[model samples]
Target: MDDRLSGYPDPDFSLGTLARMGSSRLVTKAHSLLVTDARVWPAPDERLGDTVSILIVDGVIEQIGAGLQAPDDVPRLSAEGRVVTAGFWNCHVHFTGREWSSAATAPAESLQHALDDMLLSHGFTTVLDLSSNPRTTFALMRRIATGELRGPEILTAATGLTPWRGMPFYVKADVPWVLRWLMPAPATSIGARLTVAAQIRGGAKLTKLFTGSYVRPDQVKPMRLPVARAAVAAAHRRGSRVFAHPSNRPGTEVAVEAGVDALAHVPDETEGTETLLRQAAERGIRLVPTLHMFASTVTTDDGYLAPIRAALGGFIRAGGRVLFGTDVGYMADRETRGEYEAMRASGMSTADILRSLTTEPAEFLGRADTGSVAVGNRGDLTVLQTRDDPSPADLANIQATIRAGRAIFLRDSPSKHTADAP
Candidate 1:
C-alpha cells in the first residue's frame, strides 16, 4: 500500500478515508442579501427589461421587480448593468479525477480553484454528473447542500451500466484498473435491474446506461434490449430518470425501445438519421447535444461535422427538447464557446440555447422552482458582464455565479469587493 493509503484508519477503505481527511473545510452559509440594478431574464421565455431588483431570503427568491428597495438590515449587491439569468445547468458532466474524488480532503483554496475552473466559472449552478464514483460524488453534494463547499447543485447518476463485455475500448485503454469499479457491467437482465436498484438506493437521483459503446474505432457494441429495458424499468420504478449513451443506430434503437428519458449524445448522422431523431423526439426522448464532444474527441472532417449539425437541427425542428452539456470532464475542453458556435451553426436560436441551459434541464429534473428568476424560486443565478440581449457567445463572459443567494464564483475586479454589497 502507498504510504498515504497506510495512514487511513481503515487501510481497506477508499472514499471514507479521503472524506475523513478533508472534512474540516465544510462551512455552511450564515447570511442573506439582496441584488439590485441588473438586467434580469425572469425565465427562458421572459426577460425583464433592464434594471431589476431581486430579494433573496434564506436561499430563495423572496421578491423580484423594478425599483424594489432593500431592507435596512440585509446586505445588497449592485449588478451595475450586468445581465442576470436563471442559473445555468450543464445536464451532462463527469466528476472524474483525483481533484474531484478527494476534493473534500483538499485545501480550501485548491478545491475552490478546481471547482471554479471546472464548473462554477462557466456559470453552471446546477450540473448532472452522468458518471462518477457514487460515494465521492454524494459526499461532495452533501457538503454543497450544507454550504460546506461553494459549488453547484450536483445530481449524480452514480456508476453507469454497460454490458458485461461492453466497456468502450477508448475508456478501457485509458482508465486505471482500480477506477474501473465505477463502471459496472451487468450481463443479465436481472443483474441490470439489481444494479439500477442498488444505485438508486445509494443516493443516485438518475441512472446512466451505455446503450451503445465503441469496442474499437470502427466497431460499436450495444447493450441487449432486455438488459436496457430492465434497467430503465427499475429506475423509473424508483422514481429516477435514465440517460443513455447511444453510440450509433443500434444503440439508439435499444434506448428508444427502453424508453430512456434522455440521450447522452447526438448519434452519428447516418442513413435515416433524421427519421430516427424525429421518432426519438416524438417519444419524448430529450437530447443533450454534447456537440463539442464529437468535435474535440474524434478526428473528423467537414462531412462528419455537417451530418451531426443536420441531425441536431432536424431534432430541434421536430420539437425535440435539447439540454446543454459539454462533456467537460471527459472531453477536457471546459470553455463553452465552441459548443455555442456549433449550436448556432446548427440554426439553434439564442433563446433555444438559453432554454437548454436553464428551463429545460430544471423542468426535466423536477426543479420548477429553479431555472427561472421568479419569486419563490431558488435564488440561483448566473450574472454575465455583457451587453443587453447577449448572444450565446457572450455566455463566456460570466461575471459571477450565485447559488441559493450566495455568490460562489465572482470574477476578480478592482471594485467588486463584497459579493452582496450594493
Candidate 2:
C-alpha cells in the first residue's frame, strides 16, 4: 500500500459504524489466536495425521503441537478435528460490481456480504482484484489494512490498459460513451510506461494489460509489441508483476514476447494458441486457466470447452505453473465446485490443485511468509471440515479463515464480520 497516503479523500469514507456481522466470532483480536484440535496439512503432500493445536502470538505461529497454552483471556477457535492449510489465494477477481461502489463508508455488514458471496465462503484468505474503480479499491485496501473491515488481503491493479482505441466490446456496450474515457488504451509506448508507473505510485501492486482484447464480438485486438514491452519493463522495475488478459493467439504471443509474468485467463479462442502457450510455459509464465469462467459466461457446450480444457492440460504437461482462481466478481456465480471439476477434468490432481491454491501463488508472488504453515510464518490459514478423504469440493467446506491470527470468515456463522481490535 502507498504509505504516504493518509486516508480516503471522501470525508464520509469511514463513519466507523459497523455491527458485528455474525454471532460465531470465537475470537477477538488479542495479538494472539489459538486453534485447537486441527488436523494440519502444512503443505500439499505433508499432512500431520493426528490432531494438534496451533498457537499464534502477535499474528505469527509460535507453536504447533499438543497442549500448547495461552492466557485465559486470549481468543480461541476449536477446529474440532477439521483440516487446516495455508490460506487460499484467488488470483483473479474484481470489485467493480455495483454492490461495492460505496465500499468506503458502507456498513461493514454490507461489504462483508459481497465478500462472502464472492470469496470468503470459498476459503479465500487472499485475492488479486484485477480491475475496479481505483478510488473504491484504495478505500477497500485502506479499510482492510487498518482492520476496519473483515476481509481478504487484497492486491489490485489500476484501471487495466488496453490496445490503442481498444476496449472490451462487452464493457463498451454495457456502459455509456463518457465512461469509456476511464478505460485507458494508450497509443504510445512512453504513455503506457508512464501510466503503469503512476498506477504503482498510487498504490496498485500489479499491472493488468489487455494484450489481447475483444474490440468487437467478432474481433480481437492485440496491443502493440513495443507498448506491451515498455509497460512490462516499467512494472518489473518497480518489483510488480504484470498480468495479461490475452483474448487469442496473437495476444498470447504478445504476452510471451513482452515478458508478462502471468496470463490472467486462458485465451478463450484456442484455434492458433497452443504453440504460444507452450512457449509461455517454457518461459516460466504462470497461467490461471479460469476454465469455468468460459463455461459460466460464454457457453457450457462441450464443443466450446473441450479444447480450452485441453489447452490447460497441455500447459500443465509442459511444466507450466498453474494458479487456482475463479473469475468471481466478473463471472458472478460464486460457487467453486464447477471450477474444481473443470480443472480436474483438465488433468490436475488433488495435490496439483492444492499447489495452485497455496504454494504456487505464494512462490510466484514471492510471498515467503505466506503459502504454508510454519512456526515463523504468517498466521494465515484456511480450516475446513472434510469426509474421510478430501475432494476438491471438500476444500470449500470452510470452518474459518484466519489472516494474521484474526478470524475473517466463519462458515458456521457466515454473517459475522468482527473488526480486529487495535
Alpha carbon lDDT of each predicted model:
0.79, 0.80
* Model 2: CA > 4 A from native: 1-30, 413-422
Give the worst 10-residue stretch by lDDT in candidate 2: 15-24
- How far residue 310's Cα lies from its native spot in candidate 1, in Å, is 0.8
Give the Cα error of residue 283 in candidate 2, in Å: 0.6
Error of 1 at 376 (Å): 1.1
Alpha-carbon runs more than 4 Å astray in model 1: 1-31, 176-182, 414-417, 420-422
Candidate 2 is scored at a TM of 0.90
Candidate 1 lDDT tens digits, 26-77: 3345346678888887777886467878889878888888877766877677
Give one digit per residue, the lDDT tens place, for model 2 in 1-422: 22112111122222122112111222324357888888888888775457889998888899999989988755788787888888999999987666776666778778878877788778898899786656677667667666667778888785689999898886666555645665668899999998888777666788999999999888999999999999999999999899999989999999999999999998889888888889899999999989999999999999999999998988888889999888887788888888888988898877788899999999999999889888988888888876245687677677788888887778765223332333
